[model samples]
Target: MANDPSVAHDPPPYGAEVFAFSHPAQTERLDSLGDLCDPATTADLARWDLPAGARCLEIGAGTGSLALWLADRCPDGEVTATDTDLRFLSRLRHPALRVLRHDVRTQGFPPGSFDLIVARSVLCHVPARTELPARMVSWLRPGGRLYIEDPSFFPAASSPDPVVRRLGDAVTTTLAASLGSDVAAWARSFPAPLGGLGLAELGMRVHCPTLTATNAAGRAWALSVADLLPAMTRAGALSEAGGTRALAHISRPGFVDIAHAMIAMWGVRPLTRHTEPRYAG
Candidate 1:
């Protein structure tokens, strides 16, 4: 991913990127994952040249946005999306889409069953991602493709505001402490993990693009950090209300530089690879 130069640090929490906050006016809007799977996010999926009725699988298919997008693109394509949390399963409006509740770390489907598999902004959420490259890809047929987007920040990229910087650190630290897992560790390692799968690595790469909230809706979403601030402070992840104040400032009239970074990587799946032989999922 580092070689591709698109991967970077500083990413939004799952679903928070496009769905930064909810909108009361648009009472019938969809979930964040759906937005991320929009033309902008799923361009990579369109690039896939599989048959019309190809089989596609998406891990951590939040709200089934990506799967639905793929389904719509290849009308004949069958997509199976799995997520232990079914909070947004109904978001999928496509008939070819099948949503299931499954744990990526402990449960999955049969091997070599899919033509393509993708997990965007999901690797960081999984602890033993080392298992993903093979386990997830093992389900792919020969000549299949894999797309993985992760948070990629350079060796020296971070916030300058004392409060904001601390708040960012706190979120990662507290998340790990509370969940008994290190989310930051996984975010820091990417692209390289693919080599462990023994595939003809097309090489891991990412697009370290920064997204700035300049539009009206985007600004409103960026300012809706209050919901997350209180919990962060109470958890001792933040010492002061810096994040709260920063949110207010960034949402102001002159604010123009509050942006987030994202990394996306991809590779190809080969036939007949060593199955790591692990428990289900």
Candidate 2:
């Protein structure tokens, strides 16, 4: 969810473009996302029984709000917050926090080093997304948990309002097509992968925020769509005329839509590990 306002014009690398990282907008969206997920995040951590001094990793740590919260919760613990673009995370300085510029696609975190790992809206842009769960699992200590929150756009774009629905669908389709990956793939296909990795205690929860023109989340969505309209039109996925109509609809009073769906996946690494005899007896 971290985007660089300066890089918005340049075409994003096929599978790595972020739609909402400008200055004021990025801040707004971060606030919106925090409000939307705070309860779930708190509940998930509580379920995991996050221990004091727990080692945590937060990938795609956007403005580092969640990471900061984690640091506060685990005062004696350490939190590593990473993102490819570190600008937005630069301002978060804390004794328990370490910020890194790491690409989740290529770099690997130290194996079995963390007690908890979390990501939000990150895997959608990863080209090598399928193998990602195993990689994250590898970094977790035995019995540690991995929490991932990813977006599924279909639910949100399927508005009761015909004009909003049509435009929303068109915009997301074009965006995904241009990005060279299906951003919503996990919505229908994540549990199998977790099972394949032999993770235990698997569970998923879906969060779909209700939106209205007056609400923060709704305003953020509209602003983001408006910002992306120019690019969508130029890319030819969205016709200028269509973009105009969509933008108008999004801006109108009393407009309502569902914020994109966020699916949270949680799993625990087994505590016992099988190893070969030390002496090969």
Best by lDDT: 2
> Which portions of model 1 show Cα errors greater than 4 Å?
1-40, 153-157, 160-164, 180-188, 209-227, 272-281
Writing each residue's lDDT as its tens digit, candidate 2 over 11-125 gives 3642244454544566666666676777777677776577678999999887787899888888899999998777778988889999998888779977989999998877766
Provide the lowest-lDDT 10-residue window in model 1: 19-28
lDDT assessment of candidate 1: 0.57
Report lDDT (CA) for all predictions. Answer: 0.57, 0.73
Backbone clash count for every predicted candidate, in the order shown: 11, 1
lDDT of 1 by residue, 1-281 (tens): 66665775443343332222243422123343244234445765665588668888888775566777778866787888877656667555677888887777677778778888878767765556566777776777887877776543231136554534554465566544433334454545655666556555454443433323455323433433444455456667654466766666555665443233345556666655654421110
Worst 10 residues of 2 by lDDT: 272-281
